[model samples]
Target: MITLDHNTAQRIVDRAMQVIGHSVNVMTPDGVIIASGDPLRVGELHHGARHVALRGESLAVDASNAEQFTGVRHGVNVPITVGQHIVAVVGISGEPAKVLQFADLVKVTAELMLEQTALLELGQHRRRQTEDTLLALINGRAVPQSWLDRIGFDLAQPRLALIIEPAQLPGPDDFVILLMRQLELSDKSLLLAQVAPQRLLVLAPIKPASTTALRSMTEQALSLLQSSLSANVHMAVVIAAGQYIEGSLQGCYESALATMASGRRESPHSSVHCYSDDPVTILWESLRPSWQQQELLRPLQTLRAHPRHLLYVRTLQAFFDANGDVKQCAAVLHLHRNTVRYRLKGVEQLTGLSPFRLPELLHLYLALKSDDLSTKQ
Candidate 1:
């Protein structure tokens, strides 16, 4: 009867703790808090004392001993022993001396309720944990197995794994779970689990009716995500495209990892890149020799002349960039008021590049752009 007896452990802790002071707490042997007087601390993690755990004894401390410890609450962590085994612990906080007085009585009362509660909890947890293990092992239980409904794995439809490396995802644990829930209603369900810290394993069902349609939807969803979350991610999508078989999961997983490994590092110049069956991988294999690059601007030789002539040419280009405002270019380049006019006149005479002519202006623009790009490369 005693082994099967039921009790309100929280109220017992509440009543017993009321005799003491400030805030009191009771914790299981494993540190999961069972009950407390403080509303905020109830059902929270108990990490106050290590001695009560190891030696099953009481420990007292003053706040002056700790630099960052909060207040002047006296602490007593009394171990609740059941037949030489410590089942739980009652930790009291209040006026230092009074908590020590009720320590022995609280231990006996709290441990009684805690022992029974702990057993019931252990049994329930064991049952649920066993169910979880069974669900994990069973492949087809993704659909619905009455005994193994703990996990939402869609068994009827084979699943393909997708690794999402978003543009800027530091860790998308909750977001990935939300995405899976969003896909829960269809014939094929999605389950997102973290395979690695950055690699999220998405189990997408491959129902016959959902193939093409789902693929389209997935691409659209990813595109939207790209606009939203692409800042943290830089990996390409590598799908194991064929039939989803259990034997193929390893291959599929390997395929996804290989694809991620092959993903390029972020370049300061490019925002993002998507990989497909692109042959451009081998297109730019060889680097051009510097001597060959130097041969690219051969026609610019006509423009490179006397130092003073080059000066007039640079001044004329600056004037164009200032929207043909010679006075603005004059002030910026710090030339005499007439000196800017003289440079433009000299530029028109020497290179024959007219500022007013659209065609000549186009040529000058191309020359400048080509030189800038080539110079940077």
Candidate 2:
């Protein structure tokens, strides 16, 4: 049962007055005048409205019988009902015969507006509940089994979580609808919700199929999203490795976040990234901070203070990437072999580690990689 409060009742009264050209009063089921064209009567009780609400019918109060009832007026009062329940009463003030014609019309309008408001509120409430459930799942919060059961979500099933970070924010409903349609998810197997202002999280059930089939489906989905959303959105997908269950979501979310971070660093041109595509970089990123204070990185940190020091690091990276071949490193850097050698010597002098020695070369390479990761962080 829905009850009419003062705010909604006042809106109904104002709107009814616009259409009917008569003073209107909106009353609660208990006959308290919550809203009225006559502001003085707003907090008063109306006997005629109470009679109509209790009897579940329209009641006409004429001037002849107006003095018999408390707060009675010369008007027609009709019950405002939602389904079979009388939620409120609406009265049109004037001669009974003149106002009777507008009483039913105004009552219907108010009831319809209240019904629409109630439905909108109910939808918002459900959306909030859905977001709460998804947040709990992604964050690894413990929820009661009965609560999941009540919501009709099964946690034991295998599902892959994907995080979508859009460049421009879209409404949750539009985002969900467009994503579901583009991904060809037409049933309950897909759960998509906006967990933040610019981020949407999705959990899709993994069908019983080979790994190749799942990869194909994921590729197709990414293609569709990229094409549908244009170039304005970047998506990161992380597939669960082990048996897909409720407990694996946190790891998957972390993997997805790491994948996105790595993608933005390594492959900014590509709009999508998968966890399996670059596991080494992601794992190394998790361990990079611990190596921040390593002695090998100290030299690079010191070199970074020099204005033109990045040139030495790039030359060293190219040298290592070319496997210590001077000609190949020079070709990769598009610099003369002599120039590459001079930069390598500069790197050795600044870092106290020669690029030619195997042990020193390994140390410089690791240091360069750690420096890159730190800059990104």
Candidate 3:
């Protein structure tokens, strides 16, 4: 049982040493050397480990490229990975042929330890019902104080929890947990917990008044996650952006809900969409499909039959984007204001609604969204 403030990597390496009886070095999830038995090289780079990791290869290197190892006496670089992403590397200061088993052994052990530790930490972030329960668990008893000690969790920092679910899945619970903990352990977020089964909560420590930067960091976390997940699964990735609504976890649940809604509204081609960007449109898709085909795209199909109607819809969308300013719409369309008005008149004549009518506007918006559905993309 590795307790609080315990060095997880060091513990595994100790187990590795008992079998091999040789000096070994362990890197963090980010490629920095966290611990090394050799006193002379405690804080050196494991470039060889990094190289193997970057290449996703498990080979043996020797004195020829010793400089790459930063002058470590001798060692074999074994890449430590959770899935495909290289989380860390284990370097044993011995000959490959001699310590090949040891190096491989350490690699396996480190990988296993990393996987288990990640799951344990992931369980600490489950926040399904709302923010209060999640924060209480992440900051309180839902997590073991020992695990918190392992990662050195301090309440002073600002943390935001983001939830990511598969575009095509019901993937394993462990995978989600591992992913959150992997990102959290990367020194990126404060602490991550597995709340609400498929969900994860991340705690981000921010400056006293640095809400914007913290928010930016949370949004940026998506790319990192995208890189780490597998492409084999034919699914779209849904991310809930974390918001600090109240306490440290203020708006995380809200952001997650928005993100999930956007994901459901997406056409699988969309990689990311914020709820704030399209709340109503997103919600409309998830409101339990009305079996009525008319509810599907009647307005859009009607507009499609009218050749001029498609052109009109496009122009109107752009015009509305200009905030109903006719002069700006004319300039954008390379038309005189008179031509713009003529087209608007034509639209009113054909659609049975004035261009500015609220009902007509709502109908047009739905038509635009549903347009792509009938035609296979």
CA lDDT of each prediction against the hidden true structure: 0.52, 0.72, 0.61
Give per-residue CA lDDT, model 3, range 1-377, as digits (tens): 22212288778668888888988887653456777776566556666766776787765767676665665557677777775677777878777668777766787887788788877665453323224444565443365565445556654555555566655567675766566545644554434556567665555554443645544555555554545555652154556654444453434555556566555555455655555455455445434344532564654555567878767876777667776777899999888998888787777676565667777866666555555433432
Candidate 2: C-alpha lDDT: 0.72
lDDT of 2 at 11: 94
**TM-score of model number 2:** 0.70
Error of 1 at 355 (Å): 46
Relative to the unseen true structure, what is the C-alpha lDDT of residue 191 in candidate 1, on a scale of 0 to 100? 48
> Candidate order by lDDT, highest to lowest?
2, 3, 1
Task: Residues 1-377, candidate 1: write the lDDT tens digits.
Answer: 11222135476676685665446676766665666676676556655444467776776655654333233236777777765776666777765566678787777777666566767666455445543533343333332375334554334545554566444546455654443334333323344444555545555554443543544533443444334333222342222121233535544444444334334331322332222221122111122235543553443555666567467658866876687787788888988858888766665565566655777655555455445445554
Which segments of candidate 3 are over 4 A away from where they belong?
1-161, 165-178, 186-272, 291-296, 373-377
| Model 1 steric clash total | 12
Estimate the TM-score of every prediction.
0.30, 0.70, 0.43
How far off is model 2, as Cα RMSD? 6.0
Residues forming the 10-long window of minimal summed lDDT in candidate 1: 277-286
2 versus 3: better lDDT goes to: 2
Q: Over all chains combined, what TM-score does candidate 1 have? A: 0.30
Candidate 3 lDDT for residue 38: 61
Question: Ranking under TM-score, best-scoring first?
Answer: 2, 3, 1
